[model samples]
Target: MSQKTDGDIKVPSKVVVAGFISTFIEWYDFLVYGTVAALVFSQLFFPKLDAFAGTLAALSTFTVGFIARPLGGIVFGHFGDKIGRKKTLIVTLLMMAVATTGIGLLPTYDQIGIWAPIMLVVFRFFQGVSVGGEWGGVALLLMEKAAPSKRGFIGSWAQIGGYLGPLVGAGVLAVVTTFTTPQEFLAWGWRIPFLISILLFILGLWVRLVMGESHVFEKSKKAPVPIASLFRYDTKNVLGIMAVHGAQSLTLYIVIVFFAGFLKTGASFTAAQSTLSVVAYLIGATAASMFGGWLSDYTGRFKVVGAGLVLSILIAFPLFAAAATGNIYLVMLVTFTAGVACGLIYGPEPAYFGELFPTQYRYTGVSVGVQFGTLAAGSTAPIVGTFLLQWAGGGTWAVAAYLIGWQIIGLLGLMALGETRGKALEERPGA
Candidate 1:
């Protein structure tokens, strides 16, 4: 590994910036589907299904991608541990872009019958695979070049990709809907935003190809490459990491992906109103993510994360009640709170989990933890929320109870994990 010369550590290079750009594109492409599903998918693809059932079906497609994420992580993480981060990342980026573009061109249910939904599922699976491999590499690359004390801050940028990705996705949907009527928006305009994803893919691919490998992973030559061995020997860290991931994934998906859906159905908001409210929520999230990263730098990671989890637990019922009653001002207030909570929880997970393993197994460890959370938390939230809503006769209390349970579980997970906020990368395993 090359040592940084004087002043070289102060500024990130073009390649590092490119990593952020590439991650932003990857996340944006992945998140755009949820945005579309929330506003247009039910009408377009599941037109014949009942409203709640159609939503469940749409969310089911979204969860399918997440279900495929672990496989992607294992494949990419293995090669990344054995070969290198830069090359592996290039492949994931291309896969994600192509899959996203393909969805743009796919025929709708009106045109193709059952095959339309099947093909959509297939493309979504491709996206999941690509994203699974992408994040571990991107996070390591950025953090490797960061100054020792600034790892949390720099690592948080990878997370910023998650927040900002949705912002772009939702913002595009919001802007398109703001001017277009529902008939026009559903018939054609939704596809327009999806088609634009191709440009983002091309741009991301070019940037990722130019980025360099992480110095830390390169230097840890003796570190184990077998993911199973990492798990077998480091089971405790794996479990701890998975719990942290579960909390973050559940909270984020509920607030971001499901908010638009929940509002349209539960609160009976117009498409434009829901879009606008979600856009505002995302704006809060983007700011909160940056602030959370800064907070992790000054305070400990666990402290910030714990605060986020506890706050969610306390406010979940109130927030849902406000949104459920269809009070526009209260809805906005609660939505903003949920977004801020998501930002706070999400901002630290990448860095916090990344800090848990030896550099050689770092990619595998983080990816597995995150992937498990996708399975445990991400895949289940929408389905569970929908089911609860149905059983309770669309009562907002049902949704609130369901969400608060996850938050409490997350808080407990945080309490059990070791705090490694400022520990050196190399010193983390024994910290």
Candidate 2:
């Protein structure tokens, strides 16, 4: 292959496909758990608790994966920055496949007594670790390979996995639940989604194995200790990334994780209807991610992300109100719009974050920073929303207020970072 400078290098189509497929598999493994937790985990693993407490417990296990992410980020980021992005990404994919498929094979409370939930949390933690490492590698792999002007658009393909994973997860669950009786669904149907991870893992592994390492990483000065250098040199940028990403993660779990349960109980919707609503949100997110990434290529990352945060904040109260109305059409419509807002924030994010740090420690900086933000926001969103609903006497106003508050923080985060729309990957920020 002919070599070009980093500023103008054209990424191979296979590289993009590898990044997209690997990312999709990583997220699908992680997120399929959330969908199952919402629908069946409480009943299967935490059977002793009452409905509310059981749901809370199940969601808590979901958070376990997030808690493990930073550690995953720290460990994998170090190696990815030091060795290469390609190898670490392959490890993460295999880790997620094992954890997810393990969950599928696990016996529930009825079959194994107390060991069920204990083993469940163990598997979920591994899933968390896998995902924690997965995003940064793929994001950098795409961002560092693309020409400067096309970075945003190419990077968004990684973000598409974020939305599409959950979309396909919920869609698969919807299909399974539709075909199976309620009793059968609660018994075995949920496991199908988790088991399917094995197939996805094979596809992801093949593509990623064939793809080459990032040329930027190949040429950049390697950090002696990437994480330490990241803290010493780019702490502020890390915090800014956290803030910029917080609101989108918060809103995502609320819709994808919390809303399914809320609709089932609070709005009196069937499980199928609730699952379908998540599919709607994903559809909008998948489309808007492409648009936002393309727009950021022209308008700059701050403009595109800031507009998204503002729109999401404005829609917060309306979204909850529509959910309360018990009208599926209105709920789906508002949810789709909310997805659009969040997508815009997400689409430009990989390139923006990748641009913030020097290539020497870019992997560590992006992985740790984004994982911390996600752990703080996305990890707690469903559990926090559950408590807010109970505290508000089942009213959704408090939840809306909660969402708006985070969006404002995200706007502030956008203000804190410099625009990096067309910045060259090889150029250090200060030097």
Candidate 3:
């Protein structure tokens, strides 16, 4: 490893690849549940309710994972700050793998009655905690190792994994659905994706185990209580990160989780079509994230992210209207555009948030800010969107309005914070 006197460092390509793979595995474990929840959980786990209520119930359980995330952030962030990013990331990956595999093994409502859903929520909570800690650690592991000029681009490899996870998850589900009869799919196919986690876990563990800790973290003075120090010294940045992330979460999850169901129930699309739309969104998101990250290196994080939020707001109504058209290609086009817009916000996020706090508490600060933001918006987006759809007699206008509101809040949050495109990680703002 090479470090300049100005605190910039050169990270090896192998380390970046390892970080990306581990991040992909962790996110795949967490996001596979969302795909299942959208598709079959209502039928399998909440069989007793009417269709509308059942969908709501299934999505509520999905929200449980998000609800547990902040706790994961606080706990894992504590250890990550005190111990090291590499160790904490390994622990989180193990937890996620176990929890995800556990979900695969659980019996449905037909077999276990109420115990099935209860156990599902329990496993989901652990998965949430695992991922809550996973993002900040992997992000720091990459961002902290990269040269200051390349932090945004390198940090985006982690985000790319995040975007790719859903694509791969949805792809797996689409494949299983294609091979199995509807009866078989409902009976056994859904578990295949979850069960595959064990294998991915092995790969991620091997990669992460060989990777080194963040040099930037190793050089920093440790805070006795990183969370407390974070709140006391950088509360404004914390809140700003939350707002920025909250907007992106609300926008993205609405499309990822809510839109799939909307296409099925409202637009009368087939299951495969709904899944395909999500795939398109993920593809566009993944590509745009890479572009956004590279662009942020030159244009500044604030400008790119702010532009994305504004673009999201401008496209809010058009996105839903296109979905309402019931043409799969059109739906894919609009959703892909929405994904690209959201990607701009996500791509710069790791570097942007990591730059806000000193290394002493960066893990805690980033984890708490991002998780809390996700908890507030991403957690309830599907449920809230569903309720709004019902309240509006299945019209998507209300959902569009909801998205616009969050994007505006995100823009305001962007304005509240200073640009951090080229800031050195080791420099504390008020020190």
Question: For residues 156-232, could you state the per-residue lDDT of candidate 2 as single tens digits?
Answer: 99988877776677667768878999899899988998887788788888888888888888887787888888888
Per-residue CA lDDT of model 1 for 1-431, tens digit only, reads 22241012653555556556666776676667776886778777888899999987986788778888999988888877778888888888888877887888888899988888888899999999988888888777766667655666776777776657766876786688888998998888878777887776777677666666666666566444458767666677777766766766676667655666788876788766776666666766677776876788779788888887777777678767777678767777777887788778777666677777767677787787778777888678776777887899877678778777877777777776768765555622421
Query: What tens-digit string does per-residue lDDT give for candidate 3 at 1-431?
Result: 22353234577776777667766876676567766786799999999999999888887887777888899999999999999998898899889878888899999999999998899889988988888888888888888887888888888898898878766776687688889998998899899998887887887888888878887878777888888889888899888989999999998889877888788888889978887787878888888888888899899999989988988897789877887777889989888888899889898888889988888899999999999999888878887999998999988899999999998888888888879877766745443
Give Cα-based local distance difference scores for all models. 0.73, 0.85, 0.84
Show where candidate 2 strays beyond 4 Å: 1-4, 38-56, 108-114, 181-187, 324-326, 427-431
Candidate 3 deviant stretches above 4 angstroms: 1-9, 38-57, 107-115, 427-431
Order of the predicted models by lDDT, top scorer first: 2, 3, 1
What are the TM-scores, per candidate, against the unseen true structure?
A: 0.87, 0.91, 0.91
| Better by lDDT, candidate 2 or 1 | 2
Task: Give each model's clash number.
Answer: 0, 0, 0
Q: How many backbone clashes does candidate 3 have?
A: 0
Question: To one decimal, what is the Cα RMSD in angstroms of model 2 from the true structure?
Answer: 2.9
Q: Residue 371 error for model 2, in Å?
A: 1.0
